[model samples]
Target: MEKKKISIDKSACIGCGCCAGTYPEDIAIGADGLAESVTGVAEEDVASVCPVGAISVEE
Candidate 1:
């Protein structure tokens, strides 16, 4: 298995917090009101849940 990385585009984030809600362990809402990837493997569910297309996974 390979490690996965999640990255959020702050400019594209809409502060909806949906990504955080979808993956609490891997994402969080920062003080800037944007969803941030904290830790854990990046899943498709998280990217799919982002309303603003801000989340992406790195293989």
Candidate 2:
């Protein structure tokens, strides 16, 4: 199976740090105060972490 990549919608993000707090290994807070994919990959089910649905997993 192919690995899924995590995508962060900057416009939709509120910089709540929920995703980063939950998945510190794969997600982080960027300089812009928005959620960013650390390795452009998803090691866990993190799409549901965002309260605004800013995080998404892509195949």
Candidate 3:
């Protein structure tokens, strides 16, 4: 199987919780009040849901 990489740019993240709400298994809010990649991989569409364009999925 192919591997996927999920990245969250803290500077761009607004901590909106949109990603977490959409994919709780793959994302979460960190202690710093920023979005974080929980599984190191997530649905590619996750990038599109971020209002701040903070998330990215790379294959």
Best by TM-score: 3
lDDT of 3 by residue, 28-50 (tens): 99999888888999877788899
List TM-score per model, in order: 0.80, 0.84, 0.87
Which rank order by lDDT, best down to worst? 3, 2, 1
Clashing pairs in 2: none
Badly placed stretches (over 4 Å) of model 2 are: 1-3
Question: What Cα-based lDDT does every candidate model obtain?
Answer: 0.77, 0.83, 0.87
Error of 1 at 9 (Å): 0.2
Q: What is the lDDT of candidate 2?
A: 0.83
Instruction: Summarize candidate 1's per-residue lDDT along 1-59 as a digit string, tens digits.
Output: 34367778899999998878877877889998887778856675567787778777765
TM-score preference between candidates 2 and 3, better one = 3
Between candidates 1 and 2, the one scoring higher on TM-score is 2
Clashes of each: 0, 0, 0
Backbone clashes in model 3, listed as residue pairs: none
